[model samples]
Target chain A: MNILYTKNISKSYGDFWALKDINIEVPKQSIFGLLGPNGAGKTTLIRIITQIIFADTGKVHFDGREINEEDVRKMGYLPEERGLYKKMKVGEHLIYLARLKGLSRNDALTKIKYWLNKFQITDWTDKKIEDLSKGMQQKIQFIATIIHDPSLIILDEPFSGFDPINVNIIKDEILKLKNKGATIIFSTHRMESVEELCDHIALINKSNVILYGSKQDIKQNHRSNTYTVDYIGEFRNTNGQFQITDQSETEEGYIRSNIRITNDQSPNELLSILIDEVEVHAFQEKIPTMNDIFISKVNEGTNA
Target chain B: MHNIFLIIQREYITRVRKKSFLIMSIVGPLLIASLWVVPIWLSTRETDQKTIEILDDSGFFKDEFIETSSLKFEYIQTDLVEAKTEVLSSENYGLLYIPRINLDEPEGITFFSGKNPSIEVIQDLEWAMKSVVEDIKLERSSIDQATLDSLKADIDIDMINMTESGEKAGSAGVATIIGYISALMIYFFIFVYGIQILRGVIEEKSSRIVEVIVSSVKPFHLMMGKILGVGAVGLTQYIIWLVLSIMITTGISSYFNIDRKDSLPVQTEQSGVIEEEQENEFVAEMFNSLESIDFSLLAFAFLLYFIGAYLLYGSLFAAIGSAVDNDADAQQFQLPVTIPLIFSLIVLTAILREPDGNLAFWLSMIPLFSPVIMMMRIPFGVPYWEIGLSLTLLIAGFVFTTWIASRIYRIGILMHGSKVNYRILGKWLFMKN
Candidate 1:
C-alpha cells in the first residue's frame, strides 16, 4: 500500500515556482530515496509533506488521511543543517528536542539516556553543545529525531558531515529503522549511497522525476547491448554482426576486446562465433554503473 | 501547551545562566547606591586647612578671623590700588574691592585673582559678605542683638500638596526620595533587560536554530514561551538585587545612623531676593509633593505597570524577531514599537505633570503608554477611571499584539534570505492558504 502520496504538488514564491507539478508515492516498508542535485526541489517536496511549508496547489496524504498535525507526530525529520542550542547541556537539549517531537518527559529522558549510552557519549552529557564535535552534534540530532519512535522517517543529507565510520553507523541505523516496518525517505546527492541503502529511488531532475525504480532494475534497464570477451585469437572481422568497441592485447597471445551485439543476435550466438574461431578466456556483459546512469540520465533530461 | 513550556524553560535557563546576567545583578545596585552615597560623603568629610588673606580696601571690619575647622579669615587695610598689587604679589587668593554701599546700585564686588577661584573660595566670599551686610543693617536699624540673631536664622521652603478630594496631604521627605529612586531603578532595568530578550530572540532567529525548533511546536507557543522565560530570568535577577540592595541600605543606615537632617529642602527661599510670578506657578509644587509618594500605592502601581508593560512590549518584540530574517531586516520594524514606549515615558514625566490633566488621561488610556505613565501618575493621585481604563487597554493591547505577532511568526520564521517588510508582512497576514 502507498503510505505517502502526492499528485501535482506545486508551490511558488512570488514569480519563482519552487515546485512544479510533481507526483510521487512512497510505498509501505520501503527505503525510498529522493535523489537530486542541489536546488532540485527535493527539499521543497519534503517540506510539503512535513507541513513546515505549504504547497500552493497540491494534495498530500499519509496513510490515506490528508496531511495534518496528527500525521506530523508519526513522522520524523532530520534537516540538512544541524542545530543545537550551544549554551545548553547536551543531555538537556537532547531531551528537550525529543519531548518536542511528542514524547512525554519520562519517555524522552529514558530514550535520551539510552541513546547517549549507545553512542558512547554518556560522559559528555554535561558538556555544552558548543564543546561537542560536529559528528557528536550530528549524533545527538540523530538520536533526538528517532527518540519518539516514528513510523515514517524523512532525513535530508543525513550523511553530509560524517567520517566514513560514522556514515556507516548512520547507514546501519537507517537500515534498522527500515527493518522495523518504518518507511524511510532520505534525500541525498550520493548516488553510491543510494545504491548501497536505497531499496527504491525516484531521481528528480529540474522538478521532474527522470527515473524511478529499484537500484538493480534501473541499472539493468540502462544497460546497452555491450559485452567484453577475452580470446586467444587475432583481432579480425572489424565489420560484422559483432563489432569491436574496445581492443586491448593481453598476455599469452590473447586479445581482450569489448563488443556491441547487433540487435538481432543473442549473447550466446555472439559467443559461439568467438568460441569457434578462438580459445575463449572470459565473456562478461557490461552493465552500466549508477554513476554512469545518473550522469547520462541527468544530461538526457536536460537535453529533453 | 507543552510546547510553550519547553520554549519558556529553554529561554529562561539559558539567559539566567549567562555570566553577564550574574555580573550585572551584583553590580547594578552598587552603581545606584553610589549616586546618593558619594555626594553625602564628599560634603560631610573633613578636609585640610586653608588660610585666605582677603585684602578688603574699604574699612569693613577689624582684621583677624578665628580658625574654624582648619579655615581662618584675615583682613588688611590697604588701598584698592596697593591691595591689588599686594594680593597678586602675595600667595593670597585675590583682593576684594568693595566700594561704598550706595543703596541705589547693586555693588559689583571685583575678585582680582590671577586664576579662577574654586567653588569653595566663591562660597566663602559670599558667606562673609552676607555677615557684613547683616551687621551693617542691624546697626543702622538700631535692632537688638537678639533680634539680629533671630533674623539671620536660615529658613527652608517646604511644598505641601493638598487634594481636593481630601484623600491625603503630604510633602517630600526621605521616604519619598527613596521611593522615587526605587521606582526609577525598576524602570531603567526593565527597559534594559527587556531588550535583552528581544536581542536573544533575534540572535536565535538569525542563526537559524529557530527553524528546527518551530517545526514541532506552534510559533505562538515558541514566542510566548521565549518571552515568558526570559522575563522570568530578569525577574529572578531583579529580586536578588532587590533583597541585597535593601539589606545593604538598611545595614549602612543603622550602622552609622546616617540621618541627613541637613538635606536641601524642596525650595530654599533667599530672604533678601524678590520672587518672580512665573516661577511661583503651582506645577513645581505639585511635582515636588509627588516626589514623596504613598508607599503602598506607589509600590503596587510600579509592580503592575512593570509587568503589564513588559508583557505588552515583549510580545511585540518577539513578533518583530520572527518577522525578519536578520538584524538589518528587523530595524525597519523596531521604531514603530519603540516610539510609543519612549513617548509614554516622556508624556508621563514631561507633559502629564498633573495626574488630572487631559493629556495624562489620553496617554494613560492607550495600552502601550499606560504601563509607564500610570506608574508615574499613581505616585500622584489617579482617579479610578484612569487606572481602570489604562489596565483594560494594556490587557487588550497585549492580546491584539500576540495575535498579530503570531501571524508574522508563522510566516517569517520559515523564509530564508528574503527581506521581510511591511509589504510582505502585510501580504503574509492576509494570506489564507
Candidate 2:
C-alpha cells in the first residue's frame, strides 16, 4: 500500500523552481531513497510533505486522505538545517519534541529514554546540547526525530555528520524502522548507502526525475550489450568472432575475457559457439550499479 | 490550546527560573521604594536648616526677622559697611541683605554667607522680607494693626462644587499632582515589560534556538507565551513595589508626624505665631490640600490601567518580535511599537494638568493612550462610560495585535538569512499563505 504520494507538486520562488512537477509514491514498509545532488529539490519536497511550506501547485496525500494539519502528528521530519536548544539538556529536548508530535508527556519520556539508551548515549541525557560534539549532537537530533515513532519518516541528508560506525548504526535503525512497517524517505547523494538500504529510489536532477524505479530494475535497465566469459579449454587474448575488449589468463590455466558483441548475435548463439569451441566454465551478463546509473542518468539529463 | 498552555508554561518557567529575572524582580521594587522613602527620611532627619540674618537697606523696612533654637536675626543700622562687617565676622550662617527698592523696582538681594547660602534659606528670607515691606506700607496708610491683620489674612474661600451630589472642596494643585503620578506609573511598566519581550525574542533568535523550538510548536504560541509570561512577571514586580511603597509611606508618616510639633520644625521655629496672620494662612493651606485625594479611586484606576496597558503594549511587542529575523533588524520594528507607547505616556502626563478637559477625554477614548490617560482622568472624576469604553478598546487592541503577530511569526520563522523589512512583512500579512 502507498503510504505517501505527491502528484505534480511544484514550488517556486519568483523565477527559480525549487521543486518542479515532482511525482513519487512511498510504499509502506520500504526504505525509499530520494536521490539528488545539492539544489535538486529534495529539501523542497521534504518541506512540502512535512507541511512546513505549502506547494505552489500540487497535492499531497498521506494514507489516502488529503494532507491536513493533523497528518504532521504522524510524520517525522528531520530537516537539513539541524537545530536544537543549545541551553536545554538532551533528554529534555527530545521529550519536548516528541510531545510536540502528539505523544503524552509520559509516553514521550519513555520513548526518549529508550532511544537514548538504544543509541548508547544514555550518559548524555543531562548534558547540555552545546556541550556535546557535533557527532554527538547529530545523534541526539536523530533520536529526537524518531522518538515519536512516526509512521512516515522523511530524513534529508541524515548521514552528513556521522562517522562510518555511527553511519551503520543509523542505517540499521532506519532499516529496523522499515521492518516495523514504517515508510521512510531517505534523501542523500551517497549512492553506496542507496545500494545498501533502498528497496526503491527516485533520482531527481534539475527539478526533474531523470530515473526512478526499484533498485534492481533501474540498474538492470542500464546494462550495455556486453558479456564476459570464463573457460578452461581454449580462449585467446584477441578473438576473431568477437572483439575482446580485455582478457587475462588465470593461474589455473583458465582464460577470462570481456567480449563485446560486434554483430547483433544473441547471447545464446555466442554461448553455443563458446560451448562448441571451448569447455565453458562461466558466462554472465554485466549489470550496472546504482552509482553508475546515477552518474550516467545525470549526464544524460544534462545532455538532453 | 494545551500546546499554547505548554508553550506559556515553558516561557514562564524558563524566564522566571533565570537568576537575572529573579534578581531584578526583587531588586527593582526595592530600589524604587528606597528612592521614594529614603530622600524624605533623610530630608526630615537632617535637623540643620541653617538660619540667616537679613539686614534690609530699604529704610522703610528695618526689622530683624526673628530668632529661635536654630535661627537668629540681628537688625543692623542701615549701614552696608557695618552689615558687611558683621556678616563677615558673625557666627550666624549668612547675612541676607535686601537692597533698597523703590516699591516699583525689583529688589536686588545679596547673600553674605561664609559660603554660598542654600537655595531654601535664600527663598525663605525673600518671603519674609516681603512681609516687612507690606507692614511699612500699612503703617504709612495709617491703618491700625487690627484692620491690617484682618486685611492681610487670606479669607478662606469655601469651595462648593455641588450638583445634587454632596459638596466637596479640593485643592486644584493636589488633584493635578495625583493625576500625573497615576498616569506615569501605568505608562512605565507597560513599555518596560513590552520591550523586555522583544529583547528576549531577539536574544533567542540570535542564538538560533528559535529554529529548534519552532519545530515543536507554532511560532504564534511561542510569541504569545513569552509576552503573557513576561507580563505576569512584570505585574508581580509591580504589586511588590506597590505594597512596599504603601508600607514605607504609611510607616514613616505615622512615625514622624510633622504636625505634632515633635517633628522638630515647630521646635526650630521662633514662635507659634510667626505672626498672627502667617499662622492662619498656613493652617488653611494644609486643610485645603488634604481634601483632593480620592485614594480609593486612585487605587482602583491604577489596577485597570496597569493590566490594560501591559497587555496592549505586550501584544505589540510580540508582533515586533515575529516581524524581524534578528535583533539588528528588530530596531526598525522597535521604533514603531515603542513610539506609540511612549507617545501615549507623554500625552497621559500632559492630560494630568486638565484630566477633565477635552484633550484628556479624547485621548482617554483612544485604545493606545486610554489605559494611561484614563488612569490620570480617574482622579479628576471620570464617568463610567469613559472607563468602560476605554477598557473595551484596550482589550480589542490586544486581540487584534495578537492575530497580526501570529501571522508574522508563522511566515518569518522558517526564513533564515533573508532580511524582512516593512515591505515584505506588509505583503506577508495580506498573502493567504
| Candidate topping TM-score | 1
Residue-wise lDDT of candidate 1 within B1-433, one digit each (tens)? 8788878888887777789988988887676566556655554453345556665534554442334443555666667787777877876656666666553343766767778867766665667566666677677789978887787655556645565544443554433344345446545655676677667777777666676776687767888888888888878888888787777665655554555432222222232122222234344454555544666767776777777777877877877777766667677788888887667655644533466688877877888777666666665567666777788787888888777877777777666777777888888776543
How far off is residue A173 in model 2, in Å? 3.3
Query: What's the DockQ for every one of the candidates?
Result: 0.41, 0.32
Q: Supply the DockQ value of model 1.
A: 0.41
Among the numbered candidates, top DockQ falls to: 1
TM-score of chain B of each: 0.75, 0.77
Each model's fraction of native contacts = 0.33, 0.26
Q: How much is the TM-score of the A chain of model 2?
A: 0.86
Which ten-residue region of model 2 chain A has the weakest summed lDDT?
A: A234-243
Give each model's whole-structure lDDT: 0.74, 0.74
**Could you tell me which residue pairs clash in candidate 2?**
none
Clashes of 2: 0
List, residue by residue over A1-304, the lDDT tens digit for candidate 2. 8998999998876667788898998888898899977878887788788777689898999999888878887887777777676777887777767777778999988888788778878898899988998889888878877888889988878898999999999988998898988999999888888898898899888998777888888777887767888887775424566777777887587988777777778889788878877887889886677887888888887788
Model 2 C-alpha lDDT versus the unseen true structure: 0.74
